[model samples]
Target: MVKFRNAAAAFKALNGLICVYKPACVPIQQIQHTILTNLCRDLNVLPDRPHEKRVEIVGPTNAPMTVKLVPNYADNPLVCGPRYIKEDFRCSWATHLGLFTSGVLLLGINQGTKLTYLINTARLTRAYKIHGQLGKATDTYFWNGKTVEKSTYGHVTREKIDKVVAHMQAAHQKTMFEMSGVHMESQTMFDLAAQGLIRPANNNLPVIYGIKCVYFNSPNITLEIQAINEYDKYLWTIIHDLGVQLKTSAHCTGVQCIRQGKFDLDIALLRKHWQLEYIIDNMDQCRRLMEEHSLILQPKSAILSV
Candidate 1:
């Protein structure tokens, strides 16, 4: 573990990766903004005004003191230079989850920002435990998408779902394929669905390299899906087109990161951290694999090294 003397030192020492668990109803950018705000407060890196004075409560025996808490950077040139001060850390995210989809978000700090490209491009797998119903069709291709046709299917069987899933798993390779009458075009699926195409010819299909069915109830399913390409609409498309109704929104339960060759991260971190986990495994490997590797890091002397 890394240690530092003060908040400033700790801030400067914070140069690694971390995962932040995001719950439903919170946007990814909001999470990032919150983290940065808290970190700034912790580091005491807010801009200081020389003329500003704050009231201070003193001990019982002493009088209350009016103190200028922070030194003015304009007067002191050293304070403005490469010291324990920074506007913000270079930040990046590996992947994204929906506003209503709770999942693990990979966060990169400082030098760790260099790792996001590899993590994003790598063939990582995500596990989703979705609570959904079968036999309803929505025009938007998602259960929540403006219910075009409610109560579409009366009853669904495990055998039928298994067959559909098997078909999807096999259909992963097919670039141009149609499930029923819908086309699986990569970019235009959402648009096509939005246009209210009833039993359309063909649309976009995001690539699904593999899918493992963990468990299947009539209206609920737990799946571990692997995809070479990523689009938020892809998973919903598969479920909706398969003629399943969504009882509740789906959420990502776990993610497996495959970097370089083998498994690089432990999935248990999601539960432990509640949604996010910082990953450091194969950092060098990722940096090496990136096409443009430029890390803008402050000098070590700017932070307390002890």
Candidate 2:
């Protein structure tokens, strides 16, 4: 768990909740701040937290898992509207952090054929070390029953986006943003995030434009969450089985790449202090890894230093 020493820093907190599956509540003060702080550092991004709330979920087996909800105000939702009808527009979480991946579903993007929003199987929460405090990541950035800055205008139709544009103009006091199509030529998590239906936040209130802070909004959108409720059960069973086998003994081992190898790293320290794995990839990443392990990191690339 990370601690935000400065108690005054701000972060996203809309449909946010700290879920505790059991009767006991998790000591969220540190973990919450840690998630936020580490995420910020990795992506070099910053965000503000709003009001705080906690939710409790109980498992039939009496086990509990606290899923904290935190908001993340995105300047980009991976899609721009109006004039961007020709090109691809997108707002991807992993790309900003420079994560190497594929088959991503962005929160929003223009597919040329259609505009989709996918709240899929992926982690959608980020915390930061604001002003030096390690904040925990509250990851409820999904379109689940969580709250959001939305309006109940119509069903999931083209008109739905039209009203959102109007509200955004009035809310932000300008046409501050837009969406179009997407970039890159692979399946990515960024685009999968924007394939969902948008309805009015409320049914009785016709004028109640649902506008909840997107960050810390509700259910943290992640790849795992997507498969649970939306995708086919059979598909998930097969995929999960396959995924588990591929993760371990993967390409990270130095045996496969030769240039990259497992290090006798102070693994606990990496997880504890930096929230990162200390896999010795190259001389650059392993400089600190070697120093910590009292070992020297040699270059797999034998290019002589000119």
Candidate 3:
């Protein structure tokens, strides 16, 4: 772990990746602003912050005027302004989560922002544990959205859910090759499929690497999905489509990203811990994880390294 003598040192060392847990129903921009604000606040209050210096005339009207420079309490941060502000730091997020979706969010700070491009280019797969409701459909595909349709869920079973999930995974895997711009009967396509789940070369295309029903009960079902280039609405739509596939209607109740690349929820800091010390620690942890898993920076292969 890196140690700092003062806030100035800490601020300078703050150029790296950090993971944070974003709560549901909160805007991503708000989280970014809050984190940056907290960083500035903590750094400004730390010890060894230099006061603004002012040059004052020492002797007046009597002898030769002498000028001296001294620390001015009036110009101190408490009176003038904080040494750091939200604008001073540049924070960029690798993945974008929707307002209703919460999970592990990866952010790059200062020089770390450049790493985000590599991460995006790598097309890392993300895992989401989505909670969904059966027998109901919403306009926005979320449980909170206005209900548009309702039906009975008694016919749904765990076995049937698994079948549908398997079929969906297979269909997506086939689509992966189709979208890869490779000929369907070519050996290259077969070789790629034999290797395992192949990510789409185009970053804009959404592909589901894997999906399974982790938990199930009447009216409620939980699905754990590993996907690439996906957004909140896309996950919600999966639930809506699953309902259609099961001869019923369903809506998403919640969406939580469990993992992104090697970064997992365990490493994500909560809102309350967004302080300077915690952020620095999180950054170090992320750096080590990346170093250990160098494939995260490699963009050549469509197959992600386990």
Count of steric clashes across candidates, in order? 17, 87, 0
Predicted candidate 1 versus true structure: per-residue lDDT over 1-306, tens digit per residue: 233345554654556556555666678788776666555554554333333334454455566654444534454635454323335677787776676666556667787776566565443445454444454456655555555555534245566666767877776544323442345665545454444322212113244546656676654555556553445555666555555323322322223232212223433134333211122322333344332332222111111011
lDDT by candidate, in order shown: 0.48, 0.22, 0.87
Sort every candidate by lDDT, greatest first: 3, 1, 2
Ranking, TM-score, top scorer first: 3, 1, 2
Return model 3's CA RMSD, one decimal: 3.1
For residues 1-306, write the lDDT of model 2, one tens digit per residue.
223322223121111111111111222233334433453443223333233444544445567655554433232333221211212222222111111111211111112112111111221222111010011111121111133222221222223323443453354311111111222333532342233312222222111112222222111111111111111222222222222222211011000000111221222122243321111112223345435644223322111111
Name the candidate, 1 or 2, with the larger lDDT value. 1
Cα lDDT of candidate 2 equals: 0.22
Query: Which candidate wins on TM-score?
Result: 3
Worst 10 contiguous positions by lDDT, candidate 3:
297-306
Report the candidate with higher lDDT, 2 versus 3: 3
lDDT of 3 by residue, 123-163 (tens): 67899999999999999999879999999999999999999
